[model samples]
Target: MNHAIFEKNSLILLIGTLIVVSIGGIVEIAPLFMIQSTIEKVEGMRPYSPLELAGRDIYVREGCYNCHSQMIRSLRDEIERYGHYSLAAESMYDHPFQWGSKRTGPDLARVGGKYSNDWHVEHMRSPRAVVSASIMPGYPFLAQTPLKAEHIEEQMRTLRIVGVPYTDEQIENAQADLLAQVSPEAPGGAEMQKRYPNAVFADSPSKAGVTEEDALVAYLQHLGVSVDFKLYDDKANIR
Candidate 1:
């Protein structure tokens, strides 16, 4: 236990340092074992549908998280500006959650149903069209680009392996669901509705083919529709 003895012996000092670090690690990590008990369960939260998932991918690919945060901090200012402060249960199904640290644009945690599809379209095609002062870049190419429907099932399967809870039937019908979300004639709209009860589906644009814009808009529209905040009891959710 002599400090001088340990300091004089480098090997013993290394062992002692390891012991201290191990204890610190255990002290910090042991509380996580009770994480399940700490988390409050909200009933309506569901996994993303295929099209929504695709749109999330596009959002990530385009680095939307750099500007728009999906997390709303539980503070008076954030709560007033962004409706309800974001709940942990709302993003329980997200793999690597979109709790971005910066807000170059606005918080999109509750942007769902806030604007019409046409508005979203116009905004995507030209952000300045909707918000005259918007400095955001336009993504007009998304409107012309066709959706990559071929790999929708594969994406769902990959997400399933990572605790997304995508069922076999859902995975099997992923492409169908993606198509149904964007195109009227596409099969599985009813089944998609049944599978993801509150899932959002946008009307197809005037373009004949399903475009990336359809996927992105559908994803954006479904942002905060899962839980009905009107019935959400804050007291019951307090841990």
Candidate 2:
């Protein structure tokens, strides 16, 4: 009865297609240009450290993104469950941005600091130990294998090329940030402070080399921190 409908290329279809495409493209890109203002407030958020940077390289090499995503969406269930909605600035440092397309497991953007180093080590060793039903493969090597610190500088350089900000001052003061994160009250506390007035220190350097566990921990800890269970308002600042 309506054979012509199958053959017809209606003008409405073209207009609708263009409208949908335009809206999607705008929604995808417009926020990028306007987000630096909000990102400025994430003072605690910083570039990954040398060893932790190396760990990140390992994370990428392992294709952790295959199962996990780093970006949390701006939805109610996501916010209520994961924490604050994912912010544009939180991910400004990610070169390609790991806001993965699917949630095979869960969003890792805020998985930083969700567990302890020992826990992460165990989870890497055996995901089932932590999550009874996790289909994740075990990374037991992360524990048995000591991380190589040799290429840390090269890694840092590579990140710099890719837009992760690491200042000469930060590099020089890296140890200070490392110390600050380790034991802020250690005997060398005064000395570290005196030396690195502007340096941000991390805690321990796991067997995974000199990667500051603290900085990595900081990055992890910051995930989902923006989640304030309270009602939302424009004035809300990320803690």
What C-alpha lDDT, on a 0 to 100 scale, does residue 184 get in candidate 1?
47
Model 2 lDDT per residue over 1-239, tens place: 65455347677667767999999999998988976554544544567654345455566667877888887677667766766667676677776676777888888876755676566655666889999999998865554454455555555677788777877765665544444444445445555445333223334435343332333344444444443434443324423
Candidate 1 per-residue C-alpha lDDT over 2-104 given as tens digits, one digit per residue, 9 for 90 to 100: 5898979999989989999999999999998968655578878888988898888889899999999999877667777887878888887887899898999
Name model 2 segments beyond 4 Å from true.
Answer: 1-41, 173-239
lDDT of each: 0.85, 0.59
Model 1 pairs whose backbones collide: none
Best by TM-score: 1
RMSD after Cα superposition, model 2: 6.5
